[model samples]
Each structure stands twice: as structure tokens, then as C-alpha cells.
Target: MLNSINTNPGALLALQNLNATNTELTTTQSRINTGKKIANAKDNGAIWSMAKMQSASSSSLNAVKDSLQRGQSTIDVALAAGDTITDLLMKMKEKALAASDTSLNSTSLKALKADFDSLRDQITKAAENAKFNGVSLVAGSAKPLVFLANADGGNFTVNAQTLGLQGLGLSTTGTTFTTAAEAGSMISKMTAALLTATNKLSALGTASTGLDTHLTFIGKLQDSLDAGVGNLVDADLAKESAKLQSLQTKQQLGVQALSIANQSPQSILSLFKG
Candidate 1:
């Protein structure tokens, strides 16, 4: 080989190796500082894209959980009202039976009617007041209460049936009793009304239970998705720490190698002196 004075190939190769080690050191430090292996798409395109999509979906599922919780509250209120109304109906039944007797006069019948009216009014108020977040599941809106059950708004839904005085057969416009004979005829109607209210309570109870189960499931699902995203995007700190120490040590060796290569041309000077 012809020894060239102008250029040293060994020194150039050592410099290149040093620069490569420096670049690797920078990357390892960045991973340590940020705690993310793929901080951006530039780091790893496919992994970054998948992580972004999963993160957005997790965010959307959180919103759905909120909606489901609100819906559950509304259903709970309606259920409470229905249960109260059912108890009131039982009281009304007692009053109706007492007034249906021939032994009761006009005054007693009128008093019984007043007590019955009071119970009916209370039932109306209960139904009307059963609202959550401005939504009355038991009154006004006949439409079923719909809640998002999934991350995507289009996919799944939970529905609760609407209930009210009319739905419960406790509407004030019906079954008025003026006389003892009329009161006697209304006993069966009151019993039927109580049955209807009990049934409505059952339906609400079933729906509330379903919402609770779904909420639990959704919570676990979110946890899994988060873990998955973290696995894909989060840096392995232990591994990165080891890599950083290795890179730093390697960089020092690279610098020493380059210095030795630069000194090699000095050996050629010894040949000229001899």
C-alpha cells in the first residue's frame, strides 16, 4: 500500500464510527428524558399510528361512561318514585275499601275521597320530580332514555322505558267515586293500578342493574386498552438505562480510537528520520 501524506483512511473510518456512536447516544438520552420509545410518528410510524388511534378511542369511551352514569342516575330517580307510588297506592286501597261500606255516610265518603285525592296528587308530584340532569325518565318525555354504551357513538346503546302517572293507571282524570256504590266498584281498579306500578318498578330495576354491570365491564375494557397502548408506545426504562450506559462507554472508546488513528501518520515520520 502507498502511504499517502495528504489523507489518512484509518482516521476517517474512526471519525465515522465516533459520529455513529454519538448519534446513538443522543437517541438513548432522548428516550430516557421523554420516557417514550415512540414519541412521534418519526420514531416508528406503524406503532405511533396505532397508539394514537387507541388513545382517541379510549378518550371517547370515557365520554360514553359519563353518559351511561347519567342515564343510570335518571333511571334510579324514576325507580324511587315508582316504588313510593306503589306504597301510596296500597294506602289508597285501604281508604277506598273503608268508604265502600254502607255504614259510611256522605261526610265520611267525602273525607275518604279527599284522602285518596291527596295520595294521587303526591304520586303525580313524585313522577314529575323524578329527574336527573334535566331528564325525567318517568314523566313528560315518552321516548325511551338512550345512552351511549360504546366508544363509537354509532355502535351500541342502552335504553330505559319511560313511566308516568298515565302509564301507571294512577292518572287523576279516571276512577272517581262519589257514592258508596261507586267506591265499591273502584276497588278492583285500584288493585290493578297497584299491579301496574309494581311492574313499572320491576322494569326500572332491571334496567338499573344492566347499567351497573355494563359500567363495570367498560371500566375493565378501558384499563386493557390503556395497557395495550402503553405497551406499544411507552419506553422500557430499564432497557433504555442499560443502553444509555453502554452508549456512553462506547462513545469514549470511539474517541480514543479516533485519536490513535490520527497518530498513525506520525509513525511514517519515524521512517523518514531513519
Candidate 2:
């Protein structure tokens, strides 16, 4: 049943083998160029979806980490300002005690009052200026930052945690210091203010410690997310090298098979001549 005019059986076999070899070559070329077994969603739909999910989760956690960093900076500023206020209060107490001495006349007491007033001004300035990136946390204008509820299958929030100072008040009145018998009374009032400032500073220190722990947690989460992202996209040189070698061997074998199939028609030629 050989159709001699149009087709030779041997030639047809060779063509078929060549086609198969070309298909294999094309596939190998694709894998080499992309370096990924699954280049498209059609290749591995399930794995692609999983990788996308992991990427989205990483993005959310990265945002949370950024918020935590900013929170840490804000809390740091508050802690410094609080400590400075405490120190200034203590200095004012010392000045008041000195002014209460009987040996000092009215002029000396007046100068001491001026020094105490300067100290008060410095405290107010420190509190008012304790800010981070235009966000004031110590001037009684800021509230503790809270993360909003996450509704998008996320466990992290986008907002930072705020740390601020409170219960700090200042007065400029020197009436309790101006009288002779009331010198002891003035000392008592300044002492109370000093104690209050000390207590507030202690509370702030505790809150800052808590924020530090939270910061550490967020840092670890960020590191983990970074590693996950790398795992998804990063190449494994060893695995790729092995795959390249295997593909090269297969390609060589395919070429040899194709050449042998093309030479099959020569056998037919020998049969016709001899």
C-alpha cells in the first residue's frame, strides 16, 4: 500500500521523528529561558494561587512593621522629654530651697525667683517640642494610637501605636514664696510638684518598655516575611544547574534519533539498486 509518487514510508517516518524532536527542543528552550517549571497560571494553578496568597500576607505584615517602627520613635521622644522634665523640676526645687534661706534679702530672693521661672519655661518648652515628624505626643494634644480592626483576612493593622505624656501642669504664681513665714510652705508645694513629675516619668518608662517588646515582635515578623518572599522568587542555582544538564542530554539524544530516522530512506535506496 505504498504511495510512491507522493510519499515514501521511510521519509514520512523521518519527518515524524523530526517533528517530535523539534517539540522537545522547544519545550526545553522555554524552561531554560524562564528558569521556572511553572511560568504561567495554566502551568500550576494551585501553586500559583498559594504563592499569591503568601505575597499578599507578606505585604500586610510589612506595613505593620513600618507602623511599629514609627511607634518606637515616638515613644523614644516622649521618654526623653519626660526625663528632662523630671530633672528640671528637681532643679527648681533646689533653687526654691535656696531662696527660702533667711540670710538672702529681697533682692537675692527676686533673682532666685527669676531662675525658678526660667526653669519652668524650659520644662514647658521641652514638653511642647517633643514631637516626631510633626506628631506631638507630650503636649496633651495626642492620644494613644490604636490599630484598627482587620477585616481582609489579615492579622495586622496599618496604624501605629501612639505614646504620649499626660497630667503635667505648670504654674507661674510666686505668692507662696514671697512671704517670710511661708518659706516652708513654698518648699512643700514645689516638693509636691516634683513628686508628681517623678511619678509620671516612672509610668512613661514602663509604657516605653512595653512598646520595646512589641517592637521586637514586629521586627521578627518582618524578617520572616522577607525570607518567605525570597523563597517564592529566589532561584536555587544548584537545582537549575542539574535541570540544565539533564535537558542538554535529552536534547542530544533527540537529535541522534532524528538523524537516524532521516537516514532510514537510504536503506530503501540500496534495496532498489541491488
Candidate 3:
């Protein structure tokens, strides 16, 4: 090979190889540091875009889960209140049956009526106080509770159930048991009210179960989406670690080769001296 002091082809070739090795080294280091094979759109545009979209979907599912949780809590409150009302109605029925006995004195009938009225008032109080986050399902409200069901703008609804005195076909002014006839009339009303409250409580229980099921499904769906994104972009750290060491070794060797090439022009001086 002909060599000259003004231009050294070997050194230029060595420099080019070294620059290539440096570029590869930078890429490997970035993979190790970021723990992602495709950290940005430039790395792999199609895969990066897909992973980003899936990540956004996973994030949106978080809101859906939260809405379901709130709905579940509201239903839970209503169920608890409904159960209390059911128990109160059962006790009121017992009082009305006792008051209906013609053998009972006036004083005894009045006492039973007082007890029945107190229990009826408690039922109204329970229904009114069954609120969660300003929402009450059994308080005679007409609004239904709606919750996000998925990332695709879907929703779940729980229709409101009124459990008030008027809603249960009872008198808001309280029932009277002043005579055997009045007490007998109250027994029929109590039976109907008990049935109505039980049916509404059952409906609320079903809604609660549905919310729980969907919440579980949302959690699993989010996990699957996150795993999909990871599969698309997450780096294999073990492979990157090995490649990093290899590239670093290559970089050092490249530098040494360039130094040797730069010294080759000095060999031509030895020929002149001899």
C-alpha cells in the first residue's frame, strides 16, 4: 500500500469504523438506561404508537374502575338501609296483629299503636339517610345511578327504588290502631309494605353483585392492556446488558485500530532513513 504524509487512507477507514461502533454503543447504552427498546417514535414508529395508545386505554380504565366503586358503595348503603326497613316492617306487623285482638284493653291498644308509629318513623329515617356521595337509591329519588363500565364509553345503570311510606303504599301521616277495626286494617298494609321493601332490596342486591363482577373484569382488562404495552416496548435488560459490554469492547478496539492506522505513515519515514 502506498502511504503519504498529506493523506492517509487507512486512518480514514479506521475512523469511519470507529464512528460506527460509537453509534452502536450509544444506542445500547440508551436501551440499558431507559429499559425500553423503543423509548420514542423514532426508535420504532409503528410499535411506539401502538404501545402509547394501549397505555392511554389502560389509564382510562382506571376512571371506569373508580366510577364502579362509587356506584357499588352507593348500592351498599341502600341495601343496608333497606334491610333495616324490612326488619322494622316485620316488627310493625307483629304490633298490628296484637292490637287487632278485640280482647285487648284501650290502653294496651294505644301502647301497640305508639310502638308501631315509632317503627314506621324509623323506616322513613333509614330510607332518607341511605346516602353515599349525595346519592340515595331508596329515598324516593327518581334519578338512576350510572357508572362507567369500560374504556369504550359504555355504562352500567342502577335504577332508583323508592322505599318511603308513600312509595310502599302506606300513609305518610302514620297508621292508627285506635280500635280493633283500625288495627286489622293496618295488618294488611304492613304485609304489602313488607313485600314491596323486600323486592326492592332484592333488586339493589342484584345491582351490587353486577358492579362487583364488572369491577373485577375491569381490573383484569387493565392488567392485560399494561402487559400488552410492555410486550411492545419493554427492553430485555439481560440482552441489552450483554450487548453493552460487547459494544464497549468494540469501541476500545476501534480506537486502538485508528491509532495504529495514524502511525502507519511513520513507517514510510523508516524507508527513507534506510
CA error at residue 40 for candidate 1, angstroms:
1.2
Lowest lDDT 10-mer window, candidate 2? 156-165
lDDT of 3 at 228: 96
On residues 37-115, what C-alpha lDDT tens digit does candidate 1 reach at each position? Answer: 9999999999999999999888888988998888778887888877787888888888889889999888989999899
lDDT minimum window of 10 residues, candidate 3: 171-180
Highest TM-score: give the candidate number.
Answer: 3
In candidate 2, which residue ranges exceed 4 Å CA deviation? 1-39, 147-166, 174-176, 180-183, 229-235
Q: List the residue pairs that clash in candidate 1.
A: 138-163
Model 2 per-residue lDDT tens digits across residues 1-274: 5535345665566567667756655655565677555566776687666667766776776566566577667767876887787787778778878887888889988788778778877776787788887765566555555431122433322222221223443465542366434555666766777677677656656666765676677567657766775565445656766766776676677667667756655665665785
Please give, for residues 1-274, the per-residue lDDT of candidate 3 as tens digits: 7668999999999999999999988988898899999999999999999999999999999999989999989999988888898999999999999999999988898899899889988888988898998889999664787899999989899999888887788875756567888888899899999999999888889989989999999999999999999999999999999998998899999999999999998887888884
Tell me how candidate 2 scores on lDDT: 0.63
Best by lDDT: 3
Could you tell me every candidate's TM-score relative to the true structure?
0.89, 0.77, 0.96
Positional deviation of 36 in candidate 1, in angstroms?
1.7
With a 3 Å backbone cut-off (N, CA, C), the pairs that clash in candidate 2 are: 145-162
Which TM-score value belongs to model 3? 0.96
The lDDT for every candidate, in the order shown, is 0.82, 0.63, 0.90
